[model samples]
Target: MNPVIHFEMPYEDRERMAAFYRSAFGWQTQMLGPEMGNYVLATTTETETGDRGPTQPGAINGGFYGKHPDWPAQHPSVVIGVDDIRAAMEKVSASGGQVLGEPMEIPGVGHYVSFMDPEGNRVSMLQPLPRG
Candidate 1:
């Protein structure tokens, strides 16, 4: 079964949000630049070697994206990991969920895409790059 691997939330003030998470939950935050759309990576748990993910099984990490007025459903969402993005998109469509658009490569990460479930909740999927 596909697992929920990551999460995302919209932030109006990147620093403020980062500080809040850092202070309240002790999460480590890494702020990305404009090329990455000012995304903030949040590490909520101890990671394994190479920082792939949490060392503890089932523990997921998440991020924060800059909120924009043009974006729809700017709410917190979870990201599921899939083996094949195209197949997952097909399943989402078949299940009555709407795939927002074609998946985009996330540099050293993987192909990623967002969708809106039948209930109008925004969620995402990631096809991670192969581990060496």
Candidate 2:
């Protein structure tokens, strides 16, 4: 079964959000510059490699994105890891879900896409690239 691997939430101020998380939860934050769309990576666990995953089981990390007016349904969402993105997209459609758009490459991360489930909840799926 696919697992819920990551979560995402929109933030208006990157630094303020980072500070709040760091102070409240002691979560580490990495601020990416404009080259990467000003995305802030929020690390919630002690992992062997940042962004790879959480070292502890049942613990997941997430990131924060800059909120945009044009972006629809900017609510907190969970990301599921899938083995085959293409097949998963098909399954979503077949099961009364709607794939948002074409999957996009996330550099060393993987191919990622968002979709709306049968309940109209916005969720994402990711197919991580094989590590050598």
Candidate 3:
């Protein structure tokens, strides 16, 4: 497992927002094109040892940055680490949930999908690299 996960915050200026985070938190980011869509991964690290310690890894999952030029800004949404998005979606639909976004790859990372549960709290899921 990737341990910690991240959330997506809708920004008016994605580039500027990303820069702000990088500067403020010392977060390393990398642009993931095509396969991962137009999103960047935020990397956390351990300052003392400079290793993927209990706190951070060489390149953990970075939050995705984007703009909501249309919808009104709402509560921040966190993406949870899921085992299987498709199977989970099936379970969601079987109950009373609805799938919002279909399964999509996160560049060379993994896959993710968003959906609403029976209670209606906004949530997302990401399937990280399979265990070797």
Find the candidate with the highest TM-score and give its number: 1
Please provide TM-scores, in order, for all candidate models, with all chains considered together: 0.97, 0.94, 0.67
Off by over 4 Å in 2: none
Question: Residues 21-81, candidate 1, lDDT per residue (tens digit)?
Answer: 9999999999999989899999999998887789999899999999889888999999999
The C-alpha lDDT values of all candidates are 0.95, 0.91, 0.64
Model 1 / residue 126 / CA error / Å: 0.5
The reply for model 1, stretches above 4 Å from the true place, is none
Look at candidate 3 and give me any clashing residue pairs. Answer: 35-107, 36-107, 42-62
lDDT of 2 at 120: 79
Ranking by lDDT: 1, 2, 3
Model 3 ranges off by over 4 Å: 1-4, 47-61, 68-75, 118-120
- Tell me the number of clashing residue pairs for each predicted model: 0, 0, 3
Please give the ranking of all candidate structures by TM-score, highest first, separated by commas: 1, 2, 3
lDDT of 3 by residue, 58-116 (tens): 33444565654553333467777778778878877898878786787755457977777
Query: What is the Å distance of residue 40 in model 1 from its true position?
Result: 0.5
Which ten residues in a row are the worst by lDDT in model 1? 48-57
